[model samples]
Target: MEFSPRTAIVTGSDSGIGRATAVALAEAGMDVGITWHSDRAGAEHTAEQVRAAGRKAAIRQLDTTVIPGCAAVIDELAEELGGLDVFVNNAGAGDGVGFLELDHTIWARTMDINLNGAFACIQAAARRMVAAGNGGRIIAVTSVHETQPKVHAAAYVSAKHGLGGLIKTIALELAPHGITANSVAPGAISTPMSGQDGDDPEPTLYPGIPLGRSGRATEIAAVIAFLALPASSYVTGASWAADGGMLQMGPVGSAHLDSSNWRQG
Candidate 1:
């Protein structure tokens, strides 16, 4: 437990990375609010895990795209937890469509959830924190695509890219208020959504990946927990990469050379 008596709202926290983040915060001794759009059972399960960590938990329905009274939702959660301290903007979705095949609707929907939703959620959380006159942490979960361009994911890539910029801006704006904002961009993580058999997410993510493996949700969560820690009070407006040396290398080249094929193992 790193931050006790603190309240954190992790949106879309029913499963996968979001669920893991919520649990991580709970284990850090913070009371957590679990928001789910469609996974009530999963949300309750997460709450149970939080409670098991000896902290209070709250579950709420937060469709960030709607942006209807989202701050009110956070206010309620903060009241329940006794105060607001940290907020994780982990809710998002992607279209998985390439630039050419991507429809306007797909782009709009992707932006609405991935980019716009995060913006709204951050604003709502910040408003409550400022109102309560308490400094807090706001961590956004971006993707490797935030900087790397991925094929067949134009909308997703663009939205993720914008998310990083948004976090930077928020960090600058909120610094005067003693609130910190940062982003965590994770590489291919072994999640059910990535369909990696709960083992290796990307044995072949790309030859450029020096680590030669996809990351895990827990791995990413650990970095997030670092930013959320009170010790990181001096850190803000930074984008931390958890891509396993992917960024240290060159681009993901598609051209495989035949001369590279060796007969010997």
Candidate 2:
């Protein structure tokens, strides 16, 4: 419940949602472990932000696509931080190839990073939590495509859908151990991934989103921080849609459209 001095590991924390979540957890009085795949500088910057918040920061280079090594980093970071109370599986990759052009290699690569890697890290983190005899929190940063289909992102959509199910299963299995697993689904966030930069920009009004704009990384992080609290103990196996009400419309919102132009690049 009280997260003061608790430690958390956030995978792919060099930027985007992971970075925001790490900083937020630090601000909430938890020491944080930050991992990066390519951007060591970004990871260091994130660590700096965490330290600036007056929390301990551990930095590591983690390529989630690596098998045993991916999970091993979780253990290493936990040991370095003394222990772990929270794990955020935020590392993922995707491509825009159409389903018809989707090959086995691309599909495998996407699954390897987005689904398999996440599973490895979650297993490692949960094992540590159980072994320590302390309840913990497991959060995954999924996407709106987890529930909705996109035009040319078959691999990404499939992986996110699998991740959603995986979190639910983990929640069920870990409940007895006082560990909770859940996911935060973001949509059109203003991050580098979505081709946005700098401060949280004003969202452009869109017909599909009730909120009329994209979301901010900090907005999603706020939800993750809440889920990590002792107050959210009962909120396991849930997928919180932080998508500005985008999912609320689904196909019905666009079914009446007369043009295929919406799918154009």
Candidate 3:
């Protein structure tokens, strides 16, 4: 119960990592505000779990992609929570498109939803924390694309790389306020985004991932929970990769392998 009596707002709490994170926080004794963009049922289910854990829970509709008014929503939500102490911006999407084949519309929407929306949420949350004049935690759920790039995932890779850089920048700006900002970059998490086998999604994608398997949503949630804990006070502007050691796999095989056969980057 590191954050007992504290309030946390988790975006996209209906399912996946977000739902798991809400439950994890509740289990640690924090009041949780769960938001879902499209899954009201899942949100209610998470709320029930929160209550079952003996913690206060609330549900709300949140679309991080909607700007301007998102700031109002943050203010109102803070009021509802009776004051905010932590924020986890876990709502994001992935876009698969080749750079040349991607249309401007797809590119623009991808940037808006994945990067801009998160930027707005962080800004709103930081504003509230600054006003409160107390230390707080801000976490962003990014992807392995935070440092590695996927060939056909131009928009997603670009946005994730940008979001990670944005976290570093925001950390510098917020550190003076006693607020810490960090990102959890998960590699191949087995979420609805990757487990889908329809034509729209490439199910077998990234089989080359050295992890040899995709990660579960709860696995990623546990990492986020660690960052939200009070014990992580000294950490800021750091991105902890939760990718099962996949990111360490170089193109020429492991660094332990013979890279003498390859040219330098």
Report lDDT (CA) for all predictions: 0.81, 0.88, 0.80
- Per TM-score, the best of the predicted structures is 2
**Model 3 misplacement above 4 A:** 1-5, 196-211, 252-265
Put the candidates in lDDT order, highest first: 2, 1, 3
lDDT of 1 at 259: 62
lDDT string, candidate 3, 48-82, tens digits: 98899998888888776677666676677778878
TM agreement with the true structure for every prediction = 0.88, 0.95, 0.87
Candidate 1 runs further than 4 Å off: 1-5, 196-208, 251-265
lDDT of 2 by residue, 162-248 (tens): 999999998999988889999999988888787776535555566667888888889999999999988887899999999888887
lDDT of 1 by residue, 1-265 (tens): 2333377888888887887888899898889988888879888988988898998899888776676666767777777877778999888887777687778888888998888877877888898877877688999999888998877788899999999999999899988788899999988677756775332244435555778777788788888888888888889999999988877665343344356432221
Question: How many clashing residue pairs are found in candidate 3?
Answer: 0
Task: Highest lDDT: give the candidate number.
Answer: 2
- For candidate 3, the TM-score is 0.87
lDDT of 2 at 53: 100
